[model samples]
Target chain A: MRYFTTTVDLKDSELDHSIYVQCLQLRREVFISQMGWNLYQHMGCEFDQYDTPASVHVVALQNNAVLGCMRLLRTDNDLGNATYMILDAHLGRIPNLPSGIMDEQIQSQDTWEASRLAISSRVPTSERNAVLVDLLRTGMEYVATRGGTSLLGMMNPVFLRVFRRAGLRAYKFGRIADQRDGRLCVMKLDLEPGAAMVAA
Target chain B: MKHPIQEKFNKYGFVILAPGQVPSDAITTFSDEWKEVYFRNEFHKIDPVFEFAVRSTRNSNCTLLSEAQMTNELFEEARMFEADSNFVSVSHYGGNTMVFGGVNPELDPRATASIQHACQATHRIELLKNLDLLTDTQIDLMEMAEEGFLDKEIASEFGISLSAIAQRKQAICKAVGTDCFKSTLRLYTLQKWGGLVGEYT
Candidate 1:
């Protein structure tokens, strides 16, 4: 019931490693065992390569139990950029991708493009919604503080519904494809500076 | 025309018209219109029988189940062969009980009333306990507010007049000691959940 917002690294040492394992276990329970999502099962862990150096990990816990977790990757990362490029193939045409929160840090010389986000399904519904609200607020605040123009990403249609409910305008990208988890539609949200700042 | 079937529907939530008992033309026309809307919205996954149950019981002032209502039975049969099918196959009869009566079956009036009362009592109790920051009437008003029900709707639902409902709502707000309705609701929810606000780890 106690709530604390700290970066993943800050909680890393104090965190119960067993909770992390349970988080992964819960992910497997929902995604692999139940829904039969084939993408992460081969990874040995519920995590993927985008989880490495450039991702900001957020965790929600209650009484030392990791209830939920999400990963935010800077668009400049190798795996992160690849998401947008691959989306272009599904889209059948490329469109101008917007800059993400870490554009300045990642694309100091070149133009930055899109942020990648991955959210875990361990959290309860209400808490999950709250976490997403906080995520959008924090991301926008970070962009505003750094004088960034906008933010963009490729995300699943389900999560896109959440974003739209939170008052963000999202455009569906790419043709719907049948994944192991039913049909998925790619989507993008353009976070305007003023609006993003207010949201933050 | 004062149809006996319509009177039965008004008294009870549902009615069943036997085959050739009611005019099929009206039902067919209604069904066709509903199908257009359902398929247009990509809600074809919904079982047709269940749809008929809802439409006949909730929407229509008439109660009837025909042989064509057996389409839901076929849908169930078809879904059983699918690999990832967890369709809600049976009709829910309030609380957690599932009734086997699909197209046509005897209805239990007492069981239905008992279920309805139990659900209302449960909802009222939970709402009162959760809204500790507000009075019972205030909690009721808050629920109505959340639902965006009009004053008349709220009054009719609670068996009170429009003016009485508004006065009670205002008084409840005063008792809650908060000018902002949303903040009061949030605080009440927080208190109900052990007063741990925004403390997600």
Candidate 2:
């Protein structure tokens, strides 16, 4: 069972386009079908306005099968009324999430917001943690290599424990809100190039 | 474990090394200067300020080290690390004694209010930790539900009737005194951190 990770952009070649589609299908399966999050779906793929050309997709694959995936957007990006997921949620642009999710607005090239993190249920229970670690490690390294210093997202508090155990410096920055899907909190992970963390 | 309590104390020029299940688990913090020295030298043993903190009960221990107490080697060396002679500490005395404190030179009205806030936050974190209002099965049920398991899926996982799963979830919400099951799960996570206190996270 070989494991690897890859990053895709919409402007890339056709192969990257196919991988991105698989990522969206994986998101649909985990978020909309399983978790019941009211997200936009087209042809059995979950996505939102944040899925722009500027967005980068990090995918974890095992033996050519998509096991986990997440999306990254630089906080400085803007796409005609949308900034990033968390900031959009804070500004009341996203209806499902409660407004005022973050304390202040953030627009920095050195900061990126990660969202739509999903690990496939098809992966056996024993291997789920490994897949998640791979996906997160790749995502953090990708951000750090691109001069990103901080990664922000609204995530499950359970993942907080995962971050702590993995030696990633993460903390809940804002309030934890009870959403219909689960209890989510704004978590920030400070990324440093080649930092000490659990190996993928 | 890295709890938000440490971050709260850090905002006020205080440092809590790690708020564990016992009194000795704490280490001072002032933007990371005194932490190494405090832990390496075991300053808690000779520091009279820490002694006052250990003796405090249900109240904030605000004390200024006397000339005699300051003469101790801990205070003398700690001065180089920005440790002042005055300090304030708060505690939550339950099954375990957890202390959080920092040096504060100005005991003004805002500082007083901050002390009260620390006392309340400490009490609440501990209270939620020791609540134990839900059963083991109920706790598992909430966790599974939070993992995005549907009611029927949870019932199948637990090998119980769907109705029983619904009833247990309702019971969990009632036990945690919340109307929503997700809110109950939030409380459960807070309580779960108690067991995770000592472990590195």
Q: What are the Cα lDDT values of the candidates?
A: 0.41, 0.64
Candidate 2, residue A117: how far the Cα is off, in Å: 0.9
Chain A TM-score per model, please list them: 0.57, 0.90
The top-ranked prediction according to lDDT is: 2
Which lDDT tens digits does candidate 1 get at residues B1-201?
122222112121111222212212211112344434434644433544345444433221212334354355443443342211111112221111111111213334334444334323332232333243444455555545543567798789789898897677655544543334455544443322221112222
- DockQ scores for all predicted structures: 0.02, 0.03
RMSD of each: 15.1, 17.7
Give the TM-score of each candidate.
Answer: 0.39, 0.50
Which prediction has the highest DockQ against the true structure? 2
Model 1, A82-189: lDDT tens digits are: 543333334343322223211113222122233323234434324555655565555544444445544444443344545655677666655444332223344545
Worst 10 residues of 2 chain A by lDDT: A191-200
Error of 1 at B144 (Å): 13
Docking band of candidate 2: incorrect
